[model samples]
Target: MHWISMIGIALAANLDNLGIGVSFGARSTRVPFISNLVIAILSMIAAYLSITLGMVISQYVPSNYANWGGGALIILIGIYAVISDYKSNSKIQNENGITSYIHSPNKADKDNNKVISWKESLTLGVALALNCVVGGFGAGVTGLSPIMTTLFIGLFSLLTVDIGVRAGQQIAKTLIGKWFNLLGGVLLICIGLYEMFV
Candidate 1:
C-alpha cells in the first residue's frame, strides 16, 4: 500500500512534465529521439536534486510546517502557470513576420528552423529539471524513502511525458493547432492546488 501511494504521488507530480513535453512536442515536430532522451535524463536529475534538498530541509523544519510550505509553493507555481498560459495563448509574430497559431502543426517546424542550438537544448533541459525539482520537494516532504521513490517516480514521469510529447507532435499535424501550453498550465495549477490543500 505504501509503495502504491508513493507511485501515485509520483504519477501525480508528473503532470507538469507531461504538459511541458506536450508543449515541446507541439512546438517542434522534428524533435530528435536523442533530444527526448536527454530531456528525460535531465528531469530525473532534477527529481534527485529536489528530493535530496527536501530531505535535508526536513531536518531543519517541523514536518507539519514543511508540508504546508510545500503546499504554498505549489499554489504559487500554479498561479504562475496560469499567468504564463494567458501570455502564451496570445498571438505573436515570429521573426519571419509570420503570425503563427499556438496549435499549428507547422509552428514547430517553423520554430525548429530558428536554430535550437546545443546551448539552447542544454538550457531547456536545466529548466525542465528545475521544474521537476520543485515538485519533487513536495514528494520528499511526504516522508517517502527518497532514492527509491525518486527512481520510480522519475521513470514513470519520463515515460508519460515522452508519450505526451509524441502525441502532441502527431496531433499538431492536423488542425490549426492546440493550446497545449494553456492546457498544461491549467493542469499544473490544478494539481498544485490539490497537493497543497488536499
Candidate 2:
C-alpha cells in the first residue's frame, strides 16, 4: 500500500522532469550530474516541507475529511495539469517566465551554455520543486510517510531526468514525450482515487 503510493506519486511528480530532460536533449543541452543533483535536492526539500504541512493539517481534521479534501486537491491538480497541457497543445498561450520554462525547459539554460551548471539549476530547480509542493502535501495528508515519499520523489526525479536526456532523439521522437503531461495527469488521478478509496 505504502509502496504503491510512493511509486505512484514519484512517477507522477517526475514526469515534468522527464519532459524537461527531453527538451534539453532536443536542444543538445546537458544537465551535468551536479546540476541534476541540485535540482533533485530542491525537489526533495520542497516535498519534505509540504508533506509536513499536510500532516499537520491531517492532525486537525477528521480522517475521512482529510482523505476527501486531500484526494480532491490531488484530483484538481491532475485536472488542471491536463487542461493546461491541452490548452498548450491547442494554441500559443502567453506564459510568464517560470511557466515558459516549465513548458520549454531550454529557457532555463539562460546563458546559451550547452551545460546546465549547478548555479543555473537553482531557479530551474525551484520551478520544478513547486510542482511537488502541493502534490506532496496532498499525499502527506493521505498518511504516506514523508521521508519515504521524499526519497522516492528525489530518486525518481534524478533517474527520470537522466534517462530522458540519455534516451535523446529516440525518446523525443516517441509519443511518450509528447504525451507526458497527459500521462502524468492520468497517473495522478489514479493515485488520488487510491488515496481516497483504498
Candidate 3:
C-alpha cells in the first residue's frame, strides 16, 4: 500500500516534467544531462524538505485530521491545475514563472544557446520543484517514506524529461498530449482519495 502511494506521488510529481520536456523538444531546446541532473537534485531536496515539514505537522495533529487535511490540500491543488490549464487565462498564467515556461519552454534556453547549461538550470530546477512541494507534504502526512519518495521523484523526473525530449514534438502534438499534466492532476486526485480511505 505504501508502495502504491509512493509510486503514485512520484508519478504525479514528474508528469509536468514530461510536458516541459516535450515543450523543449518541440522547440529543439536541449536539456543536457548535467542540467537534468541539477533539476532532479533540486526536486529531491525540495521534496525532502516539504515531506519533513509534513511529518512534523502529522506529529502534532490527529492521524485522521492530518490525513484528511493533507489529502484535501492535494486534491485542491490537483483541481486547480486542471482548471487553470483548461481555461488558459493568459493574464494570470503569464505571471506564473512555471506556467509561462510550460507554455514556452524555449525561455529556459536563455541566450538562445539551444542548450540549457547547468548554471541556467537553477531557475528551471526551482520552478519545477515547487510544483511538487505541496504534494510532497500531502504524501508525507499520509506516511509515505521521504527517502523512497524523493529517490523515485528524482529518478522519474530525470527519465520523464529525457524520454519526453526523445519523443519530441510528436508527443506534444497528440490530442491527449496537451492535457498530459492534467492527467497527472487527475492522478493526484486519485492519490488524495486513496490516502483518505486507505
TM-score of each: 0.62, 0.95, 0.92
Candidate 1, residues 1-198, lDDT tens digits: the string is 246435654664555455545666666534455655565676678777787877787778887776567556655655675676576567553433211222232333334573333444454555555656666776666445777766776676557657766776675466423444445445545545555466
Q: CA lDDT of 102 in candidate 1?
A: 24
TM-score of decoy 3 = 0.92
Q: lDDT of all predictions, in order shown?
A: 0.57, 0.88, 0.83
lDDT of 2 at 86: 95
What is the Å distance of residue 198 in model 2 from its true position?
1.1
TM match of model 2 to true structure: 0.95
Per residue, candidate 2 scores C-alpha lDDT tens digits across 20-131 of 9987887789999999999999999999999999999899999878887888888888988899779888998676776567786877788997899999889889999988
- The segments of candidate 3 whose C-alpha lies over 4 angstroms from its true place after superposition are 89-93, 96-99
The digit string of per-residue lDDT tens for model 3 on 29-64 reads 899999999999999999999988888889988877
Q: Model 3 — which ten-residue stretch has the worst lDDT?
A: 89-98
Please say which candidate is ahead in lDDT: 1 or 3: 3
